[model samples]
Target: MIVIIDNYDSFTFNIVQTLAAAPPGAPADWQQPDIRVFRNNKITVQEIADMAPDRLLISPGPCTPKEAGISVEAIQYFSGKIPILGVCLGHQSIGEAFGGKVIRAGRVMHGKTSPMHHDNRGVFFGLDNPFAGMRYHSLVVEEATLPDCFEATAHTDQAGWL
Candidate 1:
């Protein structure tokens, strides 16, 4: 099962819905796994422990980690227990949880598109090197603030990371 922790972002519901949907004419191997969505305010580590999900996906939100009221307890509880995929704000949360910093972008990047330069590693595996992606963020993670274990695998001309 895949557990998605929703951050109450405007895009959260849509993203979850899309992930839950099955593609038309999908192959037999394209199995739709069981998925669960929980709002950040209501979700707890105990619930996550009970679910025993194969992976956890942290959805993006409109504010910083501090503003979102994401507790360090939750981060600590989930870290290293399961595979995690953090989107936008959630990505920032992961960085902040590991003693990294978040900063206001030089320019707001709402509804913008950019060519992403990727090393084609990890999550970038099998993806095109210079793929186009939409940007809708006002803040960014400080590359220098990231732990040595992490690397900036992808970047864009406008946004340093995506």
Candidate 2:
């Protein structure tokens, strides 16, 4: 089962819908897996363990990780236990949990698109480089101070530097 911890983002269900849709190259037998969604502050770590989810997803939301409830705790508890995918605030929480710095971007990028560049590593692997990516954020994981254990998988020319 796949479990998602929602952080009060409006797009959480949209993500779920996207996941439910068949992938472009998916085989004929491909089907959406069982999924469960919970509020960030509603679920406990023990409850998650009992579910035995194959993957955990942290949803985007307003404010900082400190205010995102149990997201960081969930990430820390399930670091190696299972694969975890963090989006927006969740991603920032990952950085914070791993000793990286999360801070306000030089410019807020609401309803904007940027030419995201990547070396095709990590999440960008198996995809085209320098793709147009939609962005809506005012905070980011500072690349300069990112922990050695992690690397900036992607960036853009129109960055937070304004």
Candidate 3:
């Protein structure tokens, strides 16, 4: 099972919907995975582990990582044990949990679409280098403050990575 920890974000359901099906270019044999969603504060890391999830996904939220319930803790517990995926606030939580500093973005983007440059690896393997993606964030993970273990894969013209 794939577990999603929602951080009280409005887009949490939207993300779940997107994950429900294989995208257009995906392999034809791809099957819909069993996904379970829970509020960040409503569940504990130990309980999540009991589910034996194949993936741990943290949803974006409207506050800092310290304010998001269990988001950082989940990252701490599942780092080496399972693959963890974090979105906007979720991404910041990963950085915060790993000793990186999270702060206000130089340019806050809300409900806007922006171009992103990626290494064409991981989720971007078959996509173009500069792809347009939705932007909705006021905070960012400081690249300079990131630990040695965390390397950025995607970047935008405005901020280093989001």
Candidate 4:
């Protein structure tokens, strides 16, 4: 099962839809994991522990990590123990949890698409180089502030690696 910690972001439903959509021509043996979403404001660590998910996904939100009411310590506790994927605000939370910094971009981007350059590794695996991706963010991660353990896998000319 996969547990999604939602922060009431506008893109929450879209994220879930994208994940739930099965790829065309997937092997018959392929199986989608059972997914459950918990609101950040209402969920507790005990509830998460009870779910025993194979992975955790942090959903994007309008607020910063601090304002989102997610506990950084909790995220750190689950970091290496279970696979975690963060999107947008959630991604920022992961960085901040690891001593990274977040900042406002000079130009806010919304519903724009850009060519993404990637190392073709990890999450970028199987994706084409310079893949076209949508962008909808005002704040970004400072690459220089990333921890030594984390390396950028994708970036665009408009936004460095945020």
**On lDDT, who's better, 1 or 3?**
3
Segments of candidate 1 deviating more than 4 angstroms: 18-30, 69-72, 119-127
Task: List RMSD in Å for every model shown.
Answer: 3.3, 3.2, 2.0, 2.5
lDDT for 118 in candidate 4 is 93
- Give me the displacement of residue 56 in model 2, in angstroms: 1.2
- Residue pairs in candidate 3 whose N, alpha carbon or C atoms collide under 3 angstroms: none
| TM per candidate | 0.81, 0.84, 0.90, 0.85
Relative to the true structure, candidate 2 has a C-alpha RMSD (angstroms) of: 3.2
Please say which candidate is ahead in TM-score: 2 or 4.
4
What is the alpha-carbon lDDT for the whole of candidate 4? 0.77
Candidate lDDT scores, in order, read: 0.74, 0.79, 0.83, 0.77
Tens digits of per-residue lDDT, candidate 1, 41-127, equal 787878778978877777888778876544344566778886676788888888788888889888888998889999865446556
Question: Total clashing residue pairs per candidate?
Answer: 0, 0, 0, 0
User: How well does model 1 score by local distance difference test?
Assistant: 0.74
Candidate 4 lDDT at 53 equals 74
**How accurate locally is residue 122 in candidate 2, as Cα lDDT from 0 to 100?**
36
**Residue 64 of model 3, lDDT score:** 88
Best by lDDT: 3
Give the poorly placed runs of model 2, Cα more than 4 Å off.
26-30, 118-129, 160-162
Q: Highest TM-score, which number?
A: 3
Worst 10 residues of 2 by lDDT: 22-31
